[model samples]
Target: MTSLLLVEDDAVIRTSVSLALERYGYHVTTADDGLSGLEAAQTGGHDLLLLDVMLPSLDGISLCRKIRETSQVPILMMSARGDGLDVVAGLEGGADDYVVKPVDLPVLVARIRSLLRRTTIAQPQPETGQVGATLAFGELSVDTGSLEVRRAGQRLELSPTELRLLLEFAAHPGIVLERATLLRTVWDYGWDGDSRVVDLCVQRLRKKVGAERIETVRGFGYRLNTT
Candidate 1:
């Protein structure tokens, strides 16, 4: 059974979601506020975290940022407000994924499953290409096999999502990958409306990997600067 930490201020939500997830065979630990959630998260042993945006003491975004500082555990942010800014903030804060409030159990479970798969699935080496080769672009380098990224010989810490996005770009070199394609390939979502995840992820990736390394193509999409 997958272990999960659920942090929500609303008692009703906490209980209902906890019960629902338990039925699905997930071992869940609940917290009513961000401070406690942060404490539980720091203790570790959780496969994933379902964090609510609004909470007493500390907010979800801050808690998410705190967790990211120390751990790469998959975080799924939940918010009652479907505001674009909230979603962007959560993702920017290091959440692996986000789901709006009134979450459908099936959808939430699917998201959880997808995140687990991404973290646990081993990438098989491709035969045609230099599967385990490290690609270098200017001062930046990406090791495919180890998934390590470095700039000017300094190692850079990246989340699983960011690393995957970087690898996808490195694989194609100068190719301009469409947002829809990136959504499907990186996020595992087919909905065209889910492009924000791609955009936010790209923005985060640019911040870490350098903005100049990824060129925005105005209306088209984005391309990696190989030279």
Candidate 2:
């Protein structure tokens, strides 16, 4: 059974969400505050983490950052507000995804499944005419077989989502990839998915790979600059 750690301060929400997730075949563990949540996360050996944004002691964003410093375990943040800033902060703080509160169980489960599915790094094939296990884009190199990424001879510490996003762009090199396409391909989101995830992930990827390597195509999408 897949185990999950849920850190939520609200007693009502904590109970309800844990019960629902258990019904969905997950082994669910709960924590009511951020500090305990962080502690449980460090020792729990959970497959994933469900974190509520507001919590006593540490807050979810800080906890997420602390966890990210050592582990790449998938994190999904829940916020009572759907404000863009909150979502951005959660993502920037190392969450793989975020869900607005008044939580919809079905949607939350879907997001959880998607995050878990991505934990296994897919071996991305290089584009036609490119013949090697390692795909090189100027200073950046992605070794598809070993699932390692390096920038200018230095290994980059990237989350699974970030590495997958980089691989998608590296495989297509120079070709524009629409946000919607990325939503489906990279995140496994259906047609009405939020583009913010794509944009934010791109921003994070650029910071590691260098901003100049990825070109924004105005109203189109994004392309990995091979020149």
Quantify all predictions' global Cα lDDT against the true fold. Answer: 0.86, 0.89
Q: Over the stretch 1-227, how does candidate 2's per-residue lDDT look in tens digits? A: 99999999999999999999999999999999999999999995899999988899999999999999898888899987657777888888888888999899999999999888887654344566665588888988888776788999999988878888888898899999999999998898976687888898899889999999999998989999996
Q: Where does model 1 exceed 4 Å of error? A: 121-131
RMSD of 2: 3.4
Residues 18-50, candidate 1: write the lDDT tens digits.
Answer: 999999999999999999999999999999999
Clashing pairs in 2: none
Tally clashing residue pairs in candidate 1.
0
**Candidate 2 residue 171 C-alpha distance from true site, Å:** 1.7
Point to the candidate with the largest TM-score. Answer: 2
Lowest summed-lDDT stretch of 10 residues in model 2?
122-131
